[model samples]
Target chain A: MELRGKELNKSIATRKKEVLENTSILSEICQFLELKDVARMRSVSKIMNVIIKDSQFIWKPILQRTFPEVRILDHLTWQSLKNVYKSLRDYHYLTFEPHSSYTVGIIGSLGKLKPYPDIHSPEIESSGIFGGYSNYLLGKHIISISVLSIPSIKSIRKLRAEIQCWILQVNGQAQGWENVLDEHVTNFKMNQIKSSQILIVINSDQEYKTDFILDLEKKFKIVILKYIDNKTFENLTKAILKICRNDGETERKVYEKQLIRTNIDENSVQETNDSNNCILS
Target chain B: MFYNFNKIEEVKIRLRSAEGHICEVEESAALMSSFIRSMIEGFNEVTEVSLPNINSVVIEKVIEYMRHYKDKDPPIIKKPIISSKMEENTSAWDAGFIDADWNMVVDLMTAADYLMMIPLRDLCCAKMACKFKGRSIDELRAEYHIENEFPSEMEENLEFQHPWRLE
Candidate 1:
């Protein structure tokens, strides 16, 4: 009885192997797996690796299922689909908090951000001048960085030409900083600033300086106040500071709306007024 | 000839499995399989269908699924399943229904494919996916009995090419 049972188990195992060896069946199985799982499956065997890497049949359905909003153009090859999957996985929204007293500069190459294992709300701080480089693994390129809550339009007007932004890419050899942001770019509205390059706001007038060096293998450093004069840095800092402030009115209105819904009595109205005073103050 | 609607409802379809065992099912339930439906519709007064690839065990399981879902549709399993657990990804009944051993699940999947039962095929696929989900490459190879064919250097190269696979 024991011998027969062993043989039966062996047959079943063989049958299972046969099923997976069939490419058509394997493809069906892969369709149900997540992108990461599918990517990992490529390492299981040579056949699986070829099946996954070579076939569009496996990727097309998985891509459509995972990201239905992403349009699959006719020209996209199998490799492109794989790249799209990886790119979407790596894409993130990065928030930077520059210190008030220090001149902050962000220097890094695009698309070299390291992947974090866990998904968390990331808030990168700008370290002070001569403050050792704080390396932030960011995405391929900056699509848009909107100031979360602008204080007021009046403050925005005060921010004009105060913030200087630059995009520095060091290819093979070291080069000087290129001032990428023009006057029009500096004169951005309350929430309409869009740039493909990095945005660095430095309070040039202050003695405290924060230099951001992107930790790349190639030694690339942001030469502080070397290319542009001090006036540009001061203007850049004012604009950035204005953009970063939290809108007090918006916060108070949200609080008022919540309080009014919960409390209908006259005492609640008085409490709402008190809360508004607290927020404004 | 004039046919009564009630008479058609009372009809039973005979499904002959590979083992030459005959199982009777209500015509309505049997119609869930598109292959069976086509067979019944294409041929005149045909009630018996032979399944050469599906054995008695798998056919019975398929019949169980067809009967249960005859009145109402099975719940759709979402793509890119959220959880490794089948229960979280699908209805409790479905999760339980597909709670058989891996070999049985694979057999049912093949049977469902042959019979053109898309929902059952999809359910079987999801059950199999739950096994593969969140598993490491070595774990997957062990689970499926797949041997790593690539040399160490090639494996390292592949890993370098796909950095996202690294944690």
Candidate 2:
């Protein structure tokens, strides 16, 4: 592929060189006879016409140059390829020539133009562009940019640090301990927070890792909580085993791994016999 | 050192100036082809690369844009925060950058044209049109450096009273 590309480029360069020399020689002969340019040369009748008609003649190189990229003879003429690259390259400046062209403006339906309110507006200001509500209450806004934030993995990792700083922005108030429960509930209601949360515990009895899960459950209902699944869970388990087995916590590691891998349903209650068997065995 | 990132490409382009300082542009297939075509026909390196219409200021702006966008993907039809006030209350950054005399604006547009920077050229041209949005042809001529070519009677007949201007 590379070799073919190089050969093609060389061919183009050769053609361009021939065209350049032809133009230069024509201009030189025109200058000698005090003729203006190509148009004037064309006006000099039969001999010039015969010179132009010859395929290999230097004078008619312009016609050949018109369609250099076209190899098939069916569409090789200058007039046929007038709208192609040659004409564009030659007449680029013509587009910008004053008085030669004009501009047209097409106005569609003129919608009611309303003045956008400043920051001091009393109510929530919503303007619809093709109908996606921009939720701005009391002038808190989101400025949509032309470019998307194509975050790298490094940038995505930095987002964890910024999570602490990202205020949920609930009505101009920051959520702390006093508001965590209600704030979480409000976000849940607004469909903003995640419905599920995962808790991973390795070697619960020996390392007191169960204590952390119990404390969390005491604070918030574990309505949708579950452990990790498959490959990632296996990797995490291996890492945990590597950390704990060397630290004299074999009993806790065995029990906790089994407990986490087990799935539970909140709505369905197993029979008392099965429940006892689950907890005991 | 020039082809540090990519090994396959091998060509060099020289951008020249009046002081004879030649800045070498690393060859990419697209740019090198255009450069070679320009350099043909007794036009040397200086004549090929030197944009006579683009002064240093506009060239600096084009280079700035290129630097900013080198590693980025092309922008789609994402609507940027167009200043809420239809030609008023632009962000200070955008306003200040674009607020140049008409000559500088035209120079920047020409530079954008030479560098084939579509967005910059379009922005400058659109800004020029926006500035003359509701104005008459006579007003546009006065604002731009365009000379009036109409006969006096025809010019009088074509006069339009602009709606936006208080005067």
Candidate 3:
């Protein structure tokens, strides 16, 4: 009886090995794994690593099944699908603290704003900006720039900020920066900021008047001021303006037309409405 | 030449397992397997189908599944199963049906694949995936009896190339 039990155990072990070694069966099994799990599975053995890395068959079905609305565009190669899967899994959140009275103008490839479901802190108001059109661009990519009224160190500690947005990429290129400024401005208007004084604060370290800033100065009334906090703002604004020059002309036209309308309807209290008043706070 | 529905339902198909054990199942239940259905179609009078790769134990389990799902379709198991527990990811019946030892699940998966029973194959695959879900590389290797074939340098390089691992 003991020998019979040993034989059965041997058969079970053999069957387990057989199932694991079979590439087709292994691949089918992988289709139900999360992206991170699949990545971890690659380290198991040479056969598993090859089965995962060599083809898109395993990844494609998982991607399609998980995100049915997201279409895999023609330009994306099979090799990049794994990376795409990883990016989709990584949810991007924008966190900042705004002063009580300061209305923050967020500009980026943002869709309609909805409350972020994950945060439970009542002190913090978190909104997730769904990038509807940009979802077609690439895997829910978002780049967000937040314009905050200079916060007192006390208010910064008091209020917690978490904003989510999609950053767009096309053909593995960082295309979110292109024509994003105009979209940012449009989204700002949609948020209904009635402030006549628009502040364009640059960080203390960055060169004061980049051509992009100069171009922005041409469109809005000019004041250049320094901000001490958050070095990320400098890099983000520079990146946005650096790419904003070439294709920005068309968007600039549409923005100028909107600006004229906003000045007339929203900021009627200000007497001189030649260009929207921008004060560097 | 009209056939009575009750008569067709009364037909029994005999399945011969690898261990030469014969199991009888309703014709309608047996036809759930595309492999058996094709065999029956090819030879109209074929009442017994041979499954050489599947053992008697696994074949009996497959027959149970076929009998339960004879008149209806199995609930679809969603891809990238959200939970590690099979019960949370699928119907209670499916979860209970698949609640077996790892060896049994593997054998059932192999049998389902051989029999061309896609729903059963997918259910088994999902159950297997549940074992793999949220497990670390070392854990996976240990559980599956896989030897780490990569050298230290190659493993490091592979880790560096992993997009998700960097973060």
Instruction: Return the top candidate by lDDT.
Output: 3
- Better model by lDDT: candidate 1 vs candidate 3: 3
Clashes in predicted model 2: 1
Give the TM-score of each candidate. 0.55, 0.25, 0.53
lDDT of each: 0.56, 0.33, 0.58
In terms of DockQ, the best-performing candidate is 3
Please, what are the lDDT tens digits per residue for candidate 1 over residues A70-151? Answer: 4332233545555565556665322222332221222332212222222111222211111111111123421121121112
Candidate 3: regions farther than 4 A off: A1-11, A67-79, A89-281, B1-9, B163-167
Error of 3 at A182 (Å): 42
- List, residue by residue over B73-126, the lDDT tens digit for candidate 3: 999988878889999988999999999988888888889989999999999999
Q: Quality of candidate 1's docking, in CAPRI categories? A: acceptable
**lDDT digits (tens) for residues B1-167 of candidate 1:** 98787755678999999999999998999999999999999997889999989899888899999999999999888887778899998999999999998789989999999989988998998888887788898887887777788899988887887766654
TM-score of 2: 0.25
Residues B19-58 of candidate 2: C-alpha lDDT, one tens digit per residue: 4455444434224233334554346443236655555556
What lDDT tens digits, residue by residue, belong to model 3 across residues A1-281? 99999998787767777776777887899888876787777777887777776646766666657665343322234345654555555642221123111123232221222222332334333233221110221224422233322112222323323322111111112244224434433433454422122233332322334455457656443322233223223322322322232234555445444444443454342223334322122
Candidate 1: residue B132 lDDT (0-100): 77
Clash pairs (backbone) in predicted model 1:
A111-A140, A128-A209, A128-A210, A129-A209, A129-A210, A162-A235, A162-A236, A163-A235, A163-A236, A164-A236
List, for all models, the DockQ compared with the true complex: 0.41, 0.02, 0.43
User: If chain B of candidate 3 is superposed on the true chain B, what is its TM-score?
Assistant: 0.87
A68: Cα error in model 1, Å:
3.0
For model 1, report DockQ. Answer: 0.41
